[model samples]
Target chain A: MKYSILASTLLLAGGVAVLSGCSQVQEPAGICNMSAIAAQRQLAAAPSRVQGGESPLLEMPLNSVSITDYSVINKLYVRTVNARRTPTGTVEVYAQIINCTDFPLNAEARTQFYDAGQAPSEPISAWKRFNLPARTSNTYQTQSIGTQSAAFYMVELRETK
Target chain B: MRRARALPLLVLASAFSLSACQTVQNTAGTPTQYLDPGSSGVVRGVGIEGQDIRSMSDEMMRDLLTVPALANASISPNVIVDAEYFQNESSSRINKNIITDRLRVDLNRASRGRMQFVGRQYADMVQSERNLNQAGVVSGGTIARTAGQLAGDYRLGGRITSIDARDPRSGMIERTHQITFEMVNLQNGQIIWSNYYDLRKAAQDDIIYR
Candidate 1:
């Protein structure tokens, strides 16, 4: 009776392990925490929230709007960013992202240009990818394709697989 | 009674096997998903892929639109994208037309009247139609006709070239492709704006590019 019970217990344990393995996504050790990356990305995109001072999104009220991002990239911090209206009247954006983690992270971001009236431009910008070295800063930039049509802009960032 | 008892056991075995079988003749499984063409393609080879084409064209278009002269010029620049001037000097077999077409089409759509595309290659058909209309054989086009076709202010052309290296031991091959784009002033024959995009990729040369 004990032998049969032991065999049945072993079988149950193996099945449990297999089931767990199937559901869990395998990522490199020590860098799999997506929540931390999400935080950083959100922080990098926070500059769009600043109203009236420097950002080209002149239509939005100060401190009332923030760039929306993937929930997990909230940790990506913005070192410095410059946003302005160019000679062509389109919004131009340049941003520096600081990676606080111990390992390199591959990330992608895209910006959507909107008219002052909060209307989104047709066909969102392509997702541009960049590599951030551990404890280093990476720069990303984009210009609106439509000249007079772009007044306000919002950027989204996420960790790329 | 004996036969009845054997029949139940046989039925039980068949039912158990059917329930446990992994392969079924006709049943629904996972529905297929799609991949973005700009980044990925159905075919994978040692040579260039869809991502390269998309990235190069996108970069070229972005840079081309940002040029100040195109808009600042006194007259709206008439742009032409002809295969004759755009040469493919690379070792790989690629459809160079795809690159030029994407750039021209996207730029034309987004330029907002700042630039105009001249279909010079289709001039023969246009000329033929013009003659027919002027001769009163056919009704004239809705727009008024000019004495002659408009000349292009700027001509667009480029070249696709490559450099390659190989490791004999590991049989790894690396190739770097350089795609250069330029807009030249039609009258002065001077290059107004020039840009080059290059990428180096290494992979085992197991499959052919074509």
Candidate 2:
């Protein structure tokens, strides 16, 4: 009788161990370490389906204006994003972001320019910090230093870290 | 039952004794790693940093490209960019060459055939080489040599100034750095192009900028 009781206890412990491991398996590695490019590709593949709330989506073609931090999806919104060729023959990227929250927000953004072949045409831009007043909008703009005729750009936004 | 109760006491006593023992990790010292100079890394300070140098240079280069007087001149204008005229009036201990060199190099690369950069910093080396060739000690290679060194149409001049403040009670340090860049016409002493970058930073932990 005692041996049976001990076996039952051991069985219960084993079951608890297996259940704990299964619960942990659901939490995959964090997306924070992933590169902006890879994150954009992954997000483009399987977009969110939540109703009434819009997740941070690529605003422009070739995945421009990506919010790197997932926490800021609801806190910030990209109102407009555009790219154009300057008179000097270089490309310039501009994005207007809206603050969704009542509190002031500070975010850092950087840009990477690519050529027609989808290769880096110029060095990545330094992180530029912009402040957004509560419920207001702010614009972030950067110009490419490349003399290349055709260029594409990706701008990444994240909370000041 | 008694032994089991005593076991907990013994383990607690042993743990207390062992807590005083110092231990060393098995791994080697911190490994050298590379970080992007264009982005903020672990070490940061209130003064100007690598990212500032990169961004200011890049901005200047792009803005200069838009100016027709320089980038769209009838003939490629020879510009001299050196640390001779770039002054660091700020208290920060930084090598001025780091900023001017980057600006000159980036401008030269992106300018394509629109502009020219004269190496005023290396005039002595060029002069020595020319002397050797002229003295018949060395042969002048393929391309025909020019008469003399080219004169610069515009020379880059800039100043880095700062306003520093410290809160006596809170021990907070605030610094505002204003970097001004300009291109001057050598003959008429006219400021053809000018731009300035301003940044203000506050921090509590004192970081010595070397």
Candidate 3:
């Protein structure tokens, strides 16, 4: 009887030990690291030259020209002289057109003048359209009219509608 | 009385033996929560290849585009970019084309500028023509100038440098990536803007583990 009682007690104790080993808990998945993304966004928001500066052409005489009954579109001015000549005459007159808001300005938009006059009386000269490069500036010269040169020449700036 | 006394002693001895047996059996079975405490797994080496370096560099380039120098430019401006020169001083090998392509895409998206492929394409064509001449194929450079040429007022150029080193005590590895981008006046070659970014990552294991 005593031996049987001992065997029962041992069996109970073994069952308890086995059951205790079965209880366990697991952890969940972790979050992804986003430090890189945050850093990139901060960099994007940092100030740059384009955002802080005024228009590069604001100080030039061209800025003084009034847009009278004319819409301002795209504008480009380039200074090119006949380098072959000894006393290089800086051709200052640039082509101007009244309406360019509807279409893109091309090389054909430059105006040509034969003589110094408001009206196109004789087709002695032709104006050629110019395109400006990004992040750079171009300078255009005005026609030299004897001793009294026009302070400013009008160039049509094309606007893309 | 003797039987009663022996009964408790026998029960105690049996209980001790049973607990020991259960402990051994529990250890032999599959562990539910914990890994094997006695196993010291083999430490593996990390392998960073040329492509991995290129990928990391590309990602860094994309991140760098957010810098104001490239971001503040008007979207419709013309842009020209010279091919990047890759000079590798580190022990790791990397592809130059990967860096160039990344820069191209990043700048294009950031500035809304058009790229003129003519200069590089022309140079390539001329070089190829020369090669063809040596091989006896007669060809002249007759490509007409197209209106869509990437002739921007500004030109962007830059370089990439990388460094990788291992820690002696902890055995941790670190990688450093650096890139510098500069925008210059196309006509005058004057640098108008410049910026650079550096990125570093440290990993406990040199190699990625699954």
Tens-place lDDT digits, model 1, residues A18-123: 9998999764323434565345432222234467545543332321123345432444565566677656555578788766666777666667777767678645
Task: Answer with 1 or 2, whichever has the higher lDDT.
Answer: 2
* DockQ, all candidates in order: 0.17, 0.26, 0.01
Fnat computed for model 1 = 0.11
Give a tens-digit lDDT track for model 2, residues A41-123.
Answer: 43442233576656576344453688878877667777678987777667778899888776888887888887787677777
Per residue, candidate 1 scores C-alpha lDDT tens digits across B1-210 of 999999999999999998898665796787876878655455565566766676666666666777877754456788886665889998889877778787787778777687888888789998999889889999836898799887988888789899989999999888888888999899999998898877666777476765
Worst 10 residues of 3 chain B by lDDT: B35-44
Best by TM-score: 2
Encode model 2's per-residue lDDT on B1-210: one tens digit a residue.
Answer: 999999999999999889868577778999887987767767777899887888788778878887778877899999999999999999788899999999999999888878889999999999999999899999948868999988999999999999999999999999999999999999999999999988778888878887
Question: Which of the CAPRI classes, incorrect, acceptable, medium or high, describes model 2?
Answer: acceptable
User: Which scores greater on TM-score, model 1 or model 3?
Assistant: 1
lDDT score for residue A42 of model 2? 34
Quote the lDDT for B94 in model 3. 48
Predicted structure with the largest DockQ when compared to the true one: 2
- Interface RMSDs of the predictions, in order, are 2.3, 2.1, 27.0
Which run of 10 residues does model 2 chain B get worst, by summed lDDT? Answer: B36-45
Clashes of 1: 14
